[model samples]
Target: MTAPTARIAGEESARDQGLARGVGLWSFTFSILNGVVGAGIVALPASMAAAAGGYAPFAYLAVALVMAAVVVCFAEGGSRVPTSGGAYGTVEAAFGKGAGFLAGIYMWLASVLACGGIAAALCDALGALVPALAGVGPRLAILLLILGGISWINVRSAGLAAGVIAWGTVIKLVPLGLFVAVGGLALLVGHDPAPAAVAPQGGHFSEAMLLALFAFCGMETPLGASGEVADPTRTVPRATILAMLCVLVLYVAIQVVAQGLLGAALAGSAEPLADGMRQISPALGLVLLAGGILSRFVWIGSDVLGAPRVLFAFARDGMLPAWLGAAHPRFATPHIAIWVHSAIAFALAATGTFTRLAILSTLATAGLYFLACAAALVLRRRGVAILGTPLSFRILPLAAGMGMASMVVLVAIARIDEILAFVGLTFASLALYAVMRPRIARAA
Candidate 1:
């Protein structure tokens, strides 16, 4: 006999109540792009250059391909589940409550760390533009202000948040596109570095690939927003694929421009794209800097809006404190979860460095992705229909599984500290899960 149909709890339904489906194809595409690109593309070229020399662009393409493989796996999982917990929910079904609980905790921590990093980066960009606020107090204040503003907007309405994200994405892309065009022209004129500048040295592909992985880190945010979409199964997969494609194009284009202009020098510069533009035309430097700052707003907004919804999802499932599932009665958003996540993010921003936090976040998130891919394979093998529903893409589950496994290998070899931290955190979560299991089982 078929298993019982899964029902969303009263609280989960409350949080989702009156939440109009404002995200269509373009809005969904914009949200995904805004969520994925963030501030990474601005910094990634230099990071890749340090490792792969000129072949950095190829490294990005390779990373994108690997991520795409993972995305396909996610698409299948999402098509089946289409819930807010995203990887947490998917892994739970494939593995068990214990493993699923651990995955949820890691994903929550990753989102908190990542949101903090993004906010701090935005504050840094603002400080750069307005040097008078170089003092610690002013910068901290600015960070809080930005975070508070984003939280307020997100808490207001999902539709409003989508519009902000969609517009912010357009604003961010325009300057990057201009830089690529101008830089390409300069290279053709022999006014910039030769193609040899971007060519990889004898043995640095692995390092370059790791840096490229950073650029593709936030591609999963759209999945987190599935509940807010009109038809999640269709929109989620399309948004995931479309967003990945947009990011891949923007990243590869930026790398080509940066490398063609400054070559190895691009790797050394703190602001590689801006520096490349400066080489071509000083005026373009200002434009690129402005663009970076604008892009951070989109990142901050998307993170604040998306991350809390995941928390709410977990809470509704009794995996987290019940209070976290509280929604804004009128706004139809997870206001309590938003505030809780914001508090954690603010604390992390005040304390952690970007590099350190990013490493930790990437590891945790990658672990979840790895599990999600595995779940797809497991479910397909067991012939388990997700959400008591049929699924498309039978081969996707296996591809996602292999892709995730390969990423784990890469992370182990390249980011050993992150891997260790993730494992430690996971074990700690497992201990908590063991204690909570009896309670969760009783609730079920």
Candidate 2:
């Protein structure tokens, strides 16, 4: 009996170890969804209005289409490798270790910068709801506190971190869905805003469209967690596509409702959706605003889960410290990597400029996506099998590449400073890589 019990425990331990390498399919889907629909949605209407005028809905649709293309490209690449590092791993495999190191650094910096943006946004929302902490000093302190709390959750355990993200995502989605449904109902009841209220003005289509694209950033977060997913090939693709579709529907519907409810006002308002909902029901507006704050928490949680996995993957490949590649003995999670990510995220959140951070983060991610699509083309041309699957570079990869390239161009036109920031950050990454290469190789 004792021998049989020991055998059972050993088998269970092995199973746990294997499972720790990836998460279940539903968990993967939820993680992706959580990553895609963050605090940006709260700011979407304002960004769209700034670019597209009243035609924010159309801009959203266009953004969704572009995002879909990117999603398809990610699906192809992610399905092939399904590793923790995502774009870094794919690019490394397609190119070489040097390129992989650069890609991983870019992605890591992006994730950390994103964490700062999310933390700032969360603090802003909290300050708005609590007037006592509305001052800059208090808000910054609150932001630090929030970052600390989130970091603690992340380092505690993978399941706990993922569970937090999963639940937070669901909670945030409910209000967004409600806003869409209620807004659609209002439109059906002949409460639609005037066409002038929803149409783009002065032919600023390109600018508005680019801003919309920005709103759809983070759609490929699931790929970052591919290493932790149960079935990377099937689950990563399905989860990526599904998360994007969900975000698209919610974004478009929300835009339509917001435009109808506030018209040109939606374009100018910082909290457009909340303001629009206020027009419908002040109580609901408050509720949605509260939800937006919670959504930021969800975003942070998802980032904490996803970013460390990328580091872990890079570490495994000798691009970083091998110790970072160590999985938890009991939990089978990347505990060390998680702590390192949280520490960096906390430092950035505590001190970084939000605008600069946001721009750098977005640009870095966009650049990586562009490279992933290009790599897909390269792999297809070389007749390489991606994860035992046949490689094919169809129109989707080209479209995705072009779309991302256009976005990069548009961002350059609209915000050159941000582009420069991305460039500067890339240079910093390269410097770190140069300094660490020897040590990484020696450790490997």
Best by lDDT: 1
Q: Candidate 1 lDDT (Cα, whole model)?
A: 0.73
Pairs that collide, model 2: 22-228, 23-228, 51-208, 54-198, 55-198
Stretches of model 1 off by over 4 angstroms after superposition: 1-30, 135-137, 152-163, 193-207, 225-239, 323-336, 386-398
What is candidate 2's CA lDDT for residue 272?
65
Worst 10 residues of 1 by lDDT: 1-10
Give all candidates' CA lDDT scores: 0.73, 0.69
lDDT of 1 at 355: 50
Model 1, residue 153: distance off in Å is 4.7
| Candidate 1 per-residue lDDT over residues 71-146, each given as its tens digit | 8888777766665556666676677777777777767787788778766666666676688876789978987788
Alpha-carbon deviation at 222 in model 2, angstroms:
1.4
